[model samples]
Target chain A: MTEELLRLDGVSMQYGTGETRVTALSGIDLTVSRGELVAVMGASGSGKSTLLTVAGGLTTPTSGEVIVEGNWLSQLSPRQLATLRRRSLGFVFQDFNLIPSLTVLENVTLPLELDGFPGKRAKRPGLDALASVELLDKADRYPVDLSGGQQQRVAIARAVVGGRSLILADEPTGALDSTTGEVVLRMLRSRVDAGAGGILVTHDARHAAWADRIVFIRDGRLVDEAQTPPVTTLFEGADR
Target chain B: MSIRQSFLAILDQGACYGYQLRAEFDRRTGSTWPLNIGQIYSTLDRLERDGLVERTEADDSDHVYYAITPTGHDEVAQWLVSPVVRSTAAPRDELAMKLAIAITLPGVDITALIQAQRQATLRNLQELTRAKRAGGDGGAGDDLSWQLVIDSLIFQAEAEVRWLDHSETRLVRAKASGLAEPMPIDETRARRGRPARGGVPIDGKARA
Candidate 1:
C-alpha cells in the first residue's frame, strides 16, 4: 500500500463572522497518498484555492485537522510548522511564480536553503529537479529569458525539488497554450509516477483528466469523487 | 466516412488490387477505420457498377486489379475540393434527451447522474491522452493521421465534460431559485397532435 502524504479531516475554513461571514470550505476530508495525483475541480467561488492553501498549511483551517506525513499540523510549533512546510510542501500557481531576478537553479534550491540545507549542498538536487523537467541547461537563465512553458517547467522543478513529496498546483496550465500546457502536465504526471503525491486544482476538465482521481467541489464541500482507469466503456458502448 | 470516395481517390493514383486498396487505405488513414475484406469487395463491386472503376482480367495468381475510370477521376477531383456538409437537423443525442427527461422528474438525482457521466467522459479523455503519449508522434516515416484522430476524440470528451459541468451548474442554480419543480402533463390540449396544443379551440372547455 502507498503511504499517505497528506490528510485533511473535517476541514472547514471561514472568513469574518455574522453579516460578513463567508465559509470557504466545509467539513472537507481528503487524502493524498504517495504516488497519487488527486484533482480538485469546481466553479468559481467554490473554494478550490482555499482547499490547496489549507492543505499546504499556508492558511490554517477554522476547524478540523490538517496532517502531513502523519504529523498533526495543529500540534506543531510555529517554527516547526514553517520548517515542515519548507522541507516537505511545494506549491505551483497559475502564474509561474518565480522570483524574476533569480536564476532557474537558484529558484529551485531556495526551498532547500530555507530549510537549512547549505546553498552549495542544495545544487545537486536542484540540478536533478531541473533535469527531471528537461530544463537543466536553462539553470543559469532568469525567468524572463524562458518561454511561458519553460518558466512553468522551472516552477514545476522548484515544486518537486529535493525531498518535497507533496505538491499543490492551482491552475498551473492556465497561462500556457494547449500544446505547452499538455507538455507541462505530462511532466507533472511523470513526477507523480516517480512517487510524489499531488493535489491539482483546475477548472478545466482536460487538465484534471491527467489525475488519478477527481473530487468535485460545490459550495465549499466535496460533492463527488471519481477514480478513473482510462475508460474503454466509452468506445465499447457504441456498436460501431 | 465515404469509403467509395476514398477508394476512387486512391485508384486515381494507380491500379490496385482489392487487398492493396485496403492496405493503402490503412497506410494513409493510419488504420483509424478498419475495413474487412468482404466490405472491400462490396465497395469495389458498387464502384464497378457505377462505372467509377473497371475490373481488369484476373492474373495467374487470381488477383484482380481495379483501375479508375475517367468519371472516377472527375468524381475524385470534385470530392477533393468539396466541403462535406453536415445535416442541419438537430442530432438525436440520447444523453441530452435523457438528461432533459430526468431533470423534469422530481425523484431523479440529476447531479449524481451528471457527475457519473463527467467521470466517464474524463476517463475516456485520459485514455486518449495515454494513447497519444504512448504513440509518440507515430514514428518518423510520416505525419501521423492517428494523432489527429486522437485529438478529435480528446476534444469531444472535453466538450462532454464541459457540458456536464455546465448542466450541473445550471441545475443547481435553477433548483435554488425554485425553477426545478417537476412538471405534470397539461390537460388543455387538442386530441390529435404532438406537444399538445395548449389553447386549441374546443367545445367550450378550453380556449385561447
Candidate 2:
C-alpha cells in the first residue's frame, strides 16, 4: 500500500535572479504512495501549483531531488524526462485540457498514442478508462458537447488511463458547480483508491477531506499536515 | 434541543409510547442523535405535566400510548412555519476561545492548534461523506431525511475547516500588525497575595 510513486526531497524552486528573484517553493519534502491521494491546500500564491509542476517533472527545482518511482529527475536527460512524463505521469488541470476537435476517446487515447502505441491498440485502454469514469457511452462526444462535470470526468479518465501510476490534479473542479465538482472529486478519489497515487492541489477544504491525508501550504512552505481523523466511532465525543 | 416540540410533532402524526418515540426519532434522524429510554421517559413525563401530551387507554397488547393535546398540535403548526432564529450572542465554543487566548500568549503554536482542530473536523466530514455514499445509491426509497441530516453535519464540518483556514490567515495578519505581541503584566497593581485559580499560565512555551 505504501509503494512510493513520487517523492520530492528538500525541493526548492526559485525564479529570476538578484532583486527580481522570487522563491516560489521553499525546501519541501513530500511523498505520494500508491493507493494514497494527498491533498495540498493553501491560499493563492502559496506555491501549491508550483509544487505540482515540480512533482510532475514539468519544472526542475533549484535545489534538492525529485524522485518519481525511484528515478531521480535531476539525473534524467530532456528526452528521458519527456518519456517518463509521457509514460508514467498524468496531469489533470482546472480547464479540462481537452482539445476542441479531439473526440473524448481520442483525447483519452492521446497519451498512449503519443507514447508510440498504435491508435487501434490504444482504443481498448481508452474505452476502459471511459468506462471507469462512467463516461464510456459519451466516448465519441467532443469536449464542447459535454457538460462541465462530464468534461472534468473525461479529464480524470485521461489522467488515470492505461495504468498510469501517478496523477497531478490542479483544482480539477474549479470550473464546475458544487454538485458537479463533488462528482468530479469522487471520480478522482475512486481512481486513487484503485491504486493510482495522486496529488490534488485545491483551496477547498471540503474537497481536501476526500483525500487520505491533507498538507497545508503557506508562504511556499509546508506548515502542517493531517491524516484522516480516527473514525472508528463517528462523533465519539460530540454530543448530539 | 427542544425535544418537547419534537415529541409533540411526532405525536401529532400519531400516538406513540415512550420507547416508540425514541424509535421514531432514531428513524427520522438516521439515529444520529441517540435518544436513550430514560431521557425519553423523563421528557414524556415533562410533556404530560405540561399538558402538551396525555396518556391514552392501554391497548389490548398492554402498550400505553401518549396522545398530543390540541394545544400541542397548535405548537407543532407554529413551529413548522416559524424560522429558527439563532441567538445574536457569540456561541460558547471552547476551541474558538482557546485560540483567542492562545494567540495572545508568546510561545504558543496557534498553527498547530488550528491544524489539529481542522484534522478532527475533516475526519468527521470524511466519515459523514463515506456513510452517505455507502448508504444511498442502493435503496429506491426517496426518503431523504437521513441524507438531509448527514448533509447538515457535512456542511457544518466543512464550514469549521474553512474557518480554521481563515483563522490561520488572520493570525498571520495579526502578527504582522503587532496585535499578537506579548506584554508584561503591570507591577503597579501587584498585591501581596494572589488567588488560586486554574487560569492560563502566564509563562512557558506550551508546545515545547
Best model number under DockQ: 1
TM-score of decoy 2 = 0.88
Lowest lDDT 10-mer window, candidate 2 chain B?
B199-208
**Poorest 10 consecutive residues of model 1 chain A by lDDT?**
A231-240
| lDDT per residue (tens digit) for residues A78-135 in model 2 | 9999999988889999999999899999999999999999999999999999999999
How many angstroms is residue B2 displaced in model 1 relative to the true structure, after the best TM-score fit? 2.9
When only the first chain is scored, the TM-scores of the models are 0.96, 0.97
Model 1: per-residue Cα lDDT over A74-114, one tens digit each:
99998999988988888999999999988999999999988
Residue lDDT tens for model 1, B1-208? 7889999999999999999999999788656677889989999999999999999999999999999999999999999999998654546788898998898887888888888888778777777776776667445555477777777788888998888988988998998999999887768864664544544442444423
> Candidate 1 has which clashing residue pairs, if any?
none
Q: Where does model 2 exceed 4 Å of error?
A: B136-143, B183-208
B1-208 per-residue lDDT for model 2 (tens digits): 7777888899999999888898998787677788779888899898889888899888998888999998889989999999888765557888788887777677888878888888777777767777766665324454467778777888888888888988988888988997878656657865565544445344432322
Q: Assess every candidate by TM-score.
A: 0.89, 0.88
Following a full C-alpha superposition, what root-mean-square deviation does model 1 have from the true structure?
4.9
Q: Name the runs in model 1 displaced over 4 angstroms.
A: A230-239, B12-14, B27-30, B137-143, B176-178, B189-208
